[model samples]
Target chain A: MKSIRIVSDFNSNQLIRLWKNINNNIKFSNNDFNQVYQEFANYKNRNDITVFWTNAQRVIPSFNDLLEYKDFDENVCYDEVRNYAISLKTYHKEKSNISIVPSWHLPLDFKGIESQNWKFNYGPKFIISKMNMIMSEIFSQDENIYLIDSEIWFNDKIDLDINKLWYTVKVPYSNNIFLNSITTFNSILDGVLGKSKKIIILDLDNTLWGGIIGDDGIDGIKLGGHDYLGEAFLDFQKELKKLKRRGILLAICSKNNEKIAIDTIKNHSEMILKKDDFVTWRINWDDKATNIQSLMNEINLGLDSAVFLDDNPLERDLVKKALNEIEVPDLPLDPTNYSSFLRSLNYFESSTLTKEDFARSKMYKENIKRIESKKPNFSFDRWIKSTESKLKCIKINNSNIERAIQLFNKTNQMNLSTRRLNREEFLEWIKEKNRFVFLYSLKDRFGDLGIIGLVSLEINLKDAMIVDFILSCRAMGRNIENMILSHIRKFLIEKEKDSITAVYKKTSRNSPILDMLKKSDFEEITKYTFKRNNISIYFKSDPNIKFEEINDKN
Target chain B: MTIKQIVYKCLDEINLSLSDGDKLNKSKDELLIGDGGKLDSLALMIFLTDIEKNLKNHLNIDINVLDDKLMSNSNGPYKTIGTFIEYYEKKNEIN
Candidate 1:
């Protein structure tokens, strides 16, 4: 079973009950808010993942305490809390398998008739913002520290019965809060464990809209309007679009005539998702299972990475039976509940944002041209060269930091060490005088594939250590990896670095890069470590592709 | 609604998870809740709340099936389906 130890400030014994059927969860002492770091240190060597679940009230000064001190500076509490959080982060810097859940909720400053002091009313907001700042600071400082925001766990009012539960059970939360927060709570666990899905295989017809496009025609289909039914479908499509922008590949699999479906997607005015929005489609009369399989193969994604969503129960069952690894969620009877059901599934719950995420849809859109270019004569090498790809290698800066971190999180198949760095850790690494990071963006004849690769190296005298090397799957086969290495070699030569060393960390899904270091002209010095004695290897880009080196203006 | 109809409707809502044979012997005067209850506390709560929601939707009237008076009384209204119906009938009369 998955192992997890939770060190919480409040009495979170209910979490054990919530996750009883899931992982083996161990809860530490209650009301030991100040002893979190001590507990974390004790379990730092344990195999179980350590989670620091924080509540806003734990760090914020209680009103009772504030009243006790007549002349206290307000900044004292904020600074003290911030310093305490920073100390915890500093103690665990560069540590592995640690998760920090930042404070999300502060009891609302009730502006009732009892007291209407606007000055004191802003205390909760101040605490909330300060807690958020602490969380973000810790998140950036440590690669292993995953931040789970508490606010996303609730909506509108804080989802807690503090008064009743505090008096009776000392838990400070009701059953309703536990029930509602379960998914978000589990999503945080999933995020830390890297157990998130990558691809979404969508169904058309009743799935995306009210009716079948083949039967209703293009304009006749119901989507995006004041009508409730249409609005439900429209909202669902909007959610899918958001996921697409966040680097989830959206593919179409349906049992409709290709022409009719394509026409509807291309011409339907009410449709929120256009034809170009999808990475690929198998809009034919074939069975959905077969189509989904082909789509996964074409996208170079595994079945486990794909989520199939079809409104029809029979179709959902068919795909579920055929592809057991692919997640096929049961759609609610009513379309109005579609978006909520999908959101609750937590298929794409990621903790960090990178520029490549926002540009993912555009990158996939560029793939269509590559796929089409190989239709008549299928030659992978020829097609890749004919694209006339140009590589722009630039140092990692503010402009490309998001994409760099995106590559760190998303790139699996071509990652040398598979080391994921959080935003702050990444900034610190690139900012070091001895260490340098390069963010590579590729542009082909078709379009710009935004920031596809990242490489970080730590220089020590005449020797260099490859800290990170990752290339996105979309830009994998086009010799982009080789080009990145070539650029790195040039940099090393320019810096008068004589030798380079790299380590290959193997993961279940990263077998594609197991022998990458060996293939990249490095000799195996140890089990995972490799060394290249001479840095005089002559490097050249692909003949058909023109390469450029972009300077960081930022 | 009549006493027998109210009991039948409440049983019908809970019947989603129950087998037909299990629910066959249920009657208006059946002891379905509280001490020696056929349903557990959670199931009883769900059944009562669903009945209240369904009744409000159908009749445009709200009734608290688990009111403080019903719980605090020596022999509460929830002793049987018949008692529940009688309690609601008297409360509706007051309203």
Candidate 2:
């Protein structure tokens, strides 16, 4: 089981219990209070996550001097922050494990006039914000380090019940703050595990706009004019557009005439989302559940990766009953509350963004184009050759490591072993002798589908094994699967390895990998293991696709 | 609500955070903080703070449940739910 070691300045036994209530698989380990530095230096687990949290005053006692209006040296605070960052960096360099640290913030009841507190250099708020900025700048460069924004957990009212609980017990925060912080931490963990939702299936009519397009013609729909309700609907659409830019695919599942809806979306002067913004849609008079299923299939995504939004309660109920795995949030009664409600859901949390994420919706649109181009009687080879696809093999490095890790965790169907790893673990694995990871970015005449495949190999003397073979579903068809195998075989041949083997572990979603392996002429060593000798010339690079390799100086 | 009802309602709020094994009993004679108490030192503080907040919200009565009088009592008012309710009634009368 994965474990979390919490090193904090305050008592965290309660926090451990709260986390356990949320997730049972994780084992939480708490250290003594006020041992943040000691715990950071002593922690040795390379496989577990460690969290370091501290009150600024507690960690740097000199800050207390400033708090009490006594003489204080700002250099002391900077020196302490530097020392802490050094310890964190040293620990990370040695262990290469994930570490979470909450940014420093003043207590909720800290008495300071807003105008004067922020203006003075040595004010508590000023000092804490500066320290937090320095800490974030230093920690964010490390891929394995996560600096949580603690302010988001607090409100205008005091979250820390200092009068009632601070002195008697070490717990400074109220129950509500603890619960909210734990929820945010849980969602971050979900994002790290690649469990965050990817797509938003939205309904038209009352959902995206103020009225049904069937009854209210294109110009009659209330959206993006001087009207308050129309402005609210427009704001909601803008919120969705922001989410779309963050790599969450938007899809339409409306029961309306396709021409009218598409026309409205294309020509509506105030519409925030255009036709190209959506990856795919199913706008027919069919059950929303079936439409959603068809949309997911068309994009090669699972139901769990989607969140459904419908203003109609009956339609929401039907979809909920039909697909329990998909998330269908209850829309509030008022249109103005829609944007805030969607933001409150926190279903699309991501640890970081990459180039692939910025262009995800466009990539899906390109895939759909490729799908639509195929004729019913077209041969597979002829169709693939017509696309003029190119696959560029890039070595995994600091620049592209984040996307590589994302692909490793997110790709399920085309994965060989379905192994999951965080940034540090993945980097450490690749650093070992005779281990190599190569990422492949595919593009066609339609568009550039960003880095969508990852392959890692481990060599032992003359024998080599493919540790991970993951390809995004967007690049699954078009002979890329066979081309990846051929590339692996060619690389092994160049390395003078005698043979290469792949073990297909059976997962509920990984049968596609097994199917591809069986078709590639790998001799079956066991029911799950496949092997091909170096002398075997059964697999060949696809002539329809051009391949290039770029080596990195690691 | 009466003092006893307010105390029980506060306990119900605290119970939501407690595990099944650590939940506080709602009976009047149940021990709260001293010997045989369901709460540890941390839980005891949270329980008292929750009661204080709830009392102010429900009755507009500002009282510190952890005052020195209760701490100094040889047979503390926090021994059982009944004793705590009696102490709160006396404190409310003083207010």
**Model 2, residue A169: C-alpha shift (Å):** 1.3
lDDT of each: 0.66, 0.80
Query: To one decimal place, how large is model 1's interface RMSD in Å?
Result: 8.8
Under CAPRI classification, how is model 2 graded? acceptable
Per-residue CA lDDT of model 1 for B2-92, tens digit only, reads 5446657757645543434434246556776555566644445545655665566556566665555664453677777777777777876
In angstroms, how far off is A20's CA in candidate 2? 1.0
Q: Which stretches of candidate 2 lie over 4 Å from their true place?
A: A156-158, A368-554, B1-9, B24-37, B67-95
Where does the lowest 10-residue lDDT sum fall in candidate 1 chain A? A369-378
lDDT tens digits by residue: candidate 2, A1-554 = 88887778888877776677667788888777777777777866664677776788788777777777788888887878778777877776676467778888876678866676776577778898888877888887787788898888787363455556767778777777777878777777778878999999999988899875644568888999899999999999999999999999999998665777899999999999999999989886545666777788788787899999988765676677667789999999899999999898878888899989989999988886322321222244554566678999998877889999898777766788989999889877877889988899998875798998999999988999998999875566457877888888888878888899899988755766887888777888889899988635656778888898888867
Give the Cα error of residue A117 in candidate 1, in Å: 8.6
| TM-score of each candidate structure, all chains considered together | 0.52, 0.67
| lDDT measured at residue A469 in model 1 versus the true structure, 0 to 100 | 85
In terms of lDDT, the best-performing candidate is: 2
Which candidate wins on TM-score? 2
Clashing pairs in 1: A140-A424
Off by over 4 Å in 1: A1-3, A24-48, A62-72, A94-96, A108-121, A155-159, A162-164, A179-182, A225-228, A358-554, B1-95
